[model samples]
Target: MLDLWDGQLRDIGYESMGENGISGRRYFQKGRDNRTYHVHVFQVGSPHIERHLAFRDYLRTHPIEAREYGDFKQKLAQEFPYDIGSYIQGKESLVKDIEQRALEWYRDNSKLRRTTQEE
Candidate 1:
C-alpha cells in the first residue's frame, strides 16, 4: 500500500502504529520544510477507524466543542512552533477526553438509530 503512494508522499511510517487505538500506516506530504498533509491508513476492521469517524462526526455536530478544539490547536501551534511533540503532548489530555465523549455519543446514537429502524 505504501509502495503505491511512495512516489508522491514521504512515508513517515509504513508500519507506524499508535498505542492509543490508532494502529496504521502514516504518510505526509512535505514541501520544503513544511508538511502540507498527513494521512493515516487502517485496515477494514480496525477499531481506530470507528473511533476516528466517531470523533469527527461528534465534532461536526458539536460546534462549541469543535471551536474549542480548533482554538486549542491554534494556540498550541503558536506556543510550540517547530516542536510537534510538545504541541501534540499539550492536546493529548483534551483529545483523550473528547475521544471518550465521542465514543459514548457515537454508541448511543447508533443504538438510537437501530431502535428507530426496528420500530
Candidate 2:
C-alpha cells in the first residue's frame, strides 16, 4: 500500500505499530509543507471502514450538516493557523457527535432499504 502512494506519501500511523483498534495506516500528502490530502487505508473486515463510509454517505445526504462541518473547520483553521493539534482537538467533539449520528442514520437507512427490497 505504501508503495502505491510512493514519493509523496507521508505515513503517519502504521498497523505494524499495533496502536489498537482500526487505526490502520494513515497517509498524508503535502506540497511545500502544506497538507493536500489525508488517506486512510485499512484491511478488509475492519469496522472502521464501515464507520468512515457511513459518515461520508451521511454527509452526502445531509448538505446542511456538511456545510456546517466545513465552516467549522474553516473557522478552526483560522483560529489555529499554526497549530494542527489545537485545530484537531477543537473539532473532536463535533466530529464524534456527527459520527454517532451518521452511523445511526446509515444503519437505519440500510435496514429500510433491505426491508423495502424484501417486501
Candidate 3:
C-alpha cells in the first residue's frame, strides 16, 4: 500500500515521505461547511484495519449486499445530515451481523490444519 501511495504521489508530482518511521499512519485535513476536519488513515497491517478492508472486499464481491449497504448508508446520511457525530452511532448490531456472517462463511469453507495428531 505504501508502494502504491508512492507511485500515486510520484504521478501527482509529490515526493514520498520516505521511511519516516511513522508506522504508515497518516492524518490529513479536510474542509466541510467552511470548517476544517482532521482525518486519520490506518495502515493495512493494523489490527482493526483489516476488518474494514475485509468488509469492503466482501461488499465488492457481493453486488446485492453492496447495493443494499449503499442504500442504507445513503438513507442514514440523509436522516442524520446534521448529526454527523451520531452518524452510525447505533449501527453496532448491523456491524456485528456482517461480522458473524463472514465468520460463519469462513468457518464452513476454509480448511484448517490440526496441530496435534490423535493418539
Candidate 4:
C-alpha cells in the first residue's frame, strides 16, 4: 500500500498485519487536494473495531447524540487544535459510553433483523 501511494502517506503501523490477537494499523495520508485522511486497515475482525464502527453508525442515526458528539469535538478542536492525542483523550468517556450503547444496539438490532427476515 505504501509503495502504491508513492510517498504520499506517512504510515504509523497502518500496514502492520493483525496477528496473534493484535489489531490493525492506521494510515495517515495527504490527498492531491492537500486534505489529510486516516484509514484503518484491519486484517481480521475485532470487537474493538466493531464497536467503533457501531458507535459511528449509531451516532449517524441518532441526531441528538451526533450533535453532542460534534459539539464536543468542536470544543476539543478549539481547546487543542493541534493535539490529536489530547483531543481523543478528552472524549474517551463519552466514546466509551457510546461504544457500549452501540454494541448493545448492534446485537439487538441484528437479532431483530434476522428474526424479522426469517418470518
Put down candidate 4 lDDT per residue, 51-77, tens digits, no spaces.
Answer: 667887898889999899889988987
**What are the lDDT figures for the candidates, one per model?**
0.74, 0.74, 0.56, 0.65
Those runs of model 1 whose alpha carbons end farther than 4 Å from true positions after fitting are: 1-22, 29-37
* lDDT tens digits, residue span 25-112, model 2: 4444444335544456666677788898898999999999999998999999899989988988999999999999999999999999
Identify the superior model by TM-score, candidate 2 or candidate 3.
Answer: 2
- Indicate the residue-level lDDT of 100 in model 2: 98
lDDT by residue (tens digit), candidate 1, 6-97: 54444453232233234454434344334444456665676677888899999999999999999999899899989978988999999999
How far off is residue 47 in model 4, in Å?
A: 2.7
Tens-digit per-residue lDDT, 3-104, candidate 3? 555555456444444543345555333354322443335675676455555565567777887787668766777777777656566455676777666655
- In terms of lDDT, the poorest run of 10 residues in model 4 is 13-22
TM-score of 1: 0.76
lDDT of prediction 3: 0.56
Against the true structure, candidate 4 reaches a TM-score of: 0.70
| Selected candidate, larger TM-score, 1 vs 3 | 1
Alpha-carbon runs more than 4 Å astray in model 3: 1-40, 103-119
Model 2, position 52: C-alpha lDDT score? 86
Looking at model 1, residue 6 earns an lDDT score of 53
